[model samples]
Target: MNLKATLEQWRMFKAVVEAGGFNQAAEQVHKSQSSIHHAVQKLESALGLTLFFNEGRRVTLTEAGELMYRRACYLLDEAHKVESVANSLKSGVETYLRIAVDIIFPPEMLYKALNKVSQDYPLLRIELMETVLNGANTLLKEGEVDLGISPFPLNSGFSEDLCEIDFIAVAHPSHPLHALNRVLTLEDLKGHRQIVVRDSSTERKAESGWLGADQRWTVSHVRTSIDIIRQGLGFAWLPLAIIRNELETGVLKPLPLEQGGLRKALLFLCFADGDRLGPAARAFLGELRYQTMSLPSVESIAE
Candidate 1:
């Protein structure tokens, strides 16, 4: 028996299985109904198996047909990936991209953007570094990263205002601050310990959002500060994105400050050189920008 199977034959079989009939499959594959039917016949003949059973004009897959269909789907997917990788390489997409993101930025937003890039450029390598405050800026200045998302603008790079992150002063529900029962003032917070995240930069060590509380505990990362606050160790102003679940579950409660419990930090996305960015870096930036636009604007929420 002579056996010959082609990619086109497998594609026709898949389309027929998915579209429910040869006529519909022909419409999808841009082939005539007879051609689609003939391709499946040849495919079944090549494998020496009955792939489908016909009942009048309707058709259904046999057990062997279902198995072949599953294998054909895998083969087609792998073929598409091979073509995609070839095109990416020909287009000069970078093999490796390093991005420094501010720790205060929402993790979900970052992951969503990175996930999209991975789908488009599967061959690209990504290095993600989470930094605090000016740490991203430092990385960009040192030429250690291709892109940087910082809360503050860098001195020598192309930058754009990405989005504003809302920070809320919060404490554990069982903390003494919540027991005050009234709108607490700055003076009232001075006696309690404040959990502050130290700036990650080795040179500057800049600090922000300190309320001059007499007692303080400094931590390196925002996550650490949040964990400490959740334990009722101290109160800290944290990004609302990181603590939404805690706020909903009554684990953490926003402190009612006289001035306002929330503050907005403007974030910027900077490139070492916009003109020099490779295709992978540019595509990643585009995805990041698109996802940032979907986030809630500062005006949408009460200050």
Candidate 2:
């Protein structure tokens, strides 16, 4: 059978539906209207069906044409999938990598890496999705994400530990909680306001993490929560890496809690144990591992 002719007629049919007329489709597809008409006529003849009901200049698809149009879309979609697979094979790399991560890594880091890698490996592509511990792990289990950077322990047995980060709480310079040289207690934080990250689905929400917490406000992003705290709005819990400068400049002061600061490990997750990392992913992970180790410890909270 002449598959090429059938495919050409299928595409022309789609074009005509999209353009709303044969003349417009001809202009868009760079084909004469007569050529398009001839192809469709041949297609109908070969298939033993009526495709169009011609009335003067306006053309409408017959019942058979409408049914064929639907199937044609699926056929074209499959063709594009084939093309994508061929390109991926020719490029000698995987087609896609979907990574879901905790909101820890800033977009700047990923954007910078993309810019650098795209120069050398044009086919390399990375997509970033943000989720908390539960959501991130779910995507990894469902095979939605090629990887996930999570804080949750991987019971799925398909993950590896990336690195651990210390969580620290900080208060504004003028807040009452900062005036106490003694370690901050729940009672000490009771009267004061606090800014906290409220994990939610639709929007990043903020609420007090401490109840016996406080009357403080909540914010979604660490940057904004830290900003408000620096302005003396309230105290907040955040990674020390995010607030290093403010600590040094005396804009924000540590709460001096007697208990050790919260310690959370950042983990890398994949679908199977001993999964081999891709080259681009490996490079990024190498730099991240080095950077994570070099981070200043909580001892620098006084700085």
Candidate 3:
């Protein structure tokens, strides 16, 4: 069967939709606007479908466009996966590895794993992105990261239960909420401010943690949220992995809640395409698992 449209045309079409217009798509993909326009026109002609209607400078997808867009995305993803699989089989150790890790994952463990793996492959490059919430999952799905440590229910890829992060509601000892000197409730928390870490994903919908308080501040990192909390401005449910020192030093104190003071997020080790994993990616995964095996949880890390 002969197909009228090429993957490049679909790629161009997808890029135009994502970038909002042909001109933007041109800039994004490093192609001229004329070429993008021609490709999209050709795609619509071949399929006999109207994919976009243009505003002054923007393009909006028609209903049929939306349907084709989704199918095109899937097609493009599968095409990339096939190329990756072929490359893995023919190539030696990958020269570089990209990993996306949820911020809640222990930094020490990551550093140790990378260091251990790098010892054997001195020239291997690593790109480590510290993401929040769905960020790692999105990166893995988009094939941006070869590996990831992210919360489960991923849209794509293979995942295994890895570890859990213990989050506790905490605030500065000087904050008025602590002055009550009793088990705190959500009602009590409502009067105060809460700091939350922003999700790093670009396209898909993402959530900042619990918006429990009337006043809220959103930041890009957990450390930023912790820093604001330490300043007596707000309170938040923070992961214990990074806040242990602050807890011991009295820089922060846990909310005395009757119930629901703590929460847990189970993270998983995800592969971008597990069966087609390159040699370096495989080695890195093995080293990461080996390093994580010794520490069961944050409680065990302290021991």
Best by TM-score: 3
Candidate 3: regions farther than 4 A off: 1-79, 294-303
Cα RMSD, each candidate: 16.9, 8.8, 5.2
Return the TM-score for each candidate structure. Answer: 0.68, 0.58, 0.74
Residue pairs whose backbone atoms clash in candidate 1: none
Tens digit per residue, CA lDDT, model 1, 225-296? 989999999998988877777777888888999985789899999975665577878888899989887665
- Which whole-number lDDT from 0 to 100 does residue 70 have in model 2? 89
Better model by lDDT: candidate 1 vs candidate 3: 1
How many pairs of residues collide in each model? 0, 2, 1
Error of 3 at 231 (Å): 2.0
Those runs of model 1 whose alpha carbons end farther than 4 Å from true positions after fitting are 1-91, 296-303
lDDT agreement of model 3 with the native: 0.85
Candidate 2 lDDT, tens digit per residue, 22-73? Answer: 8888999999999987887787887888877776666788898889888988
Ten consecutive residues with minimal summed lDDT in candidate 1? 294-303
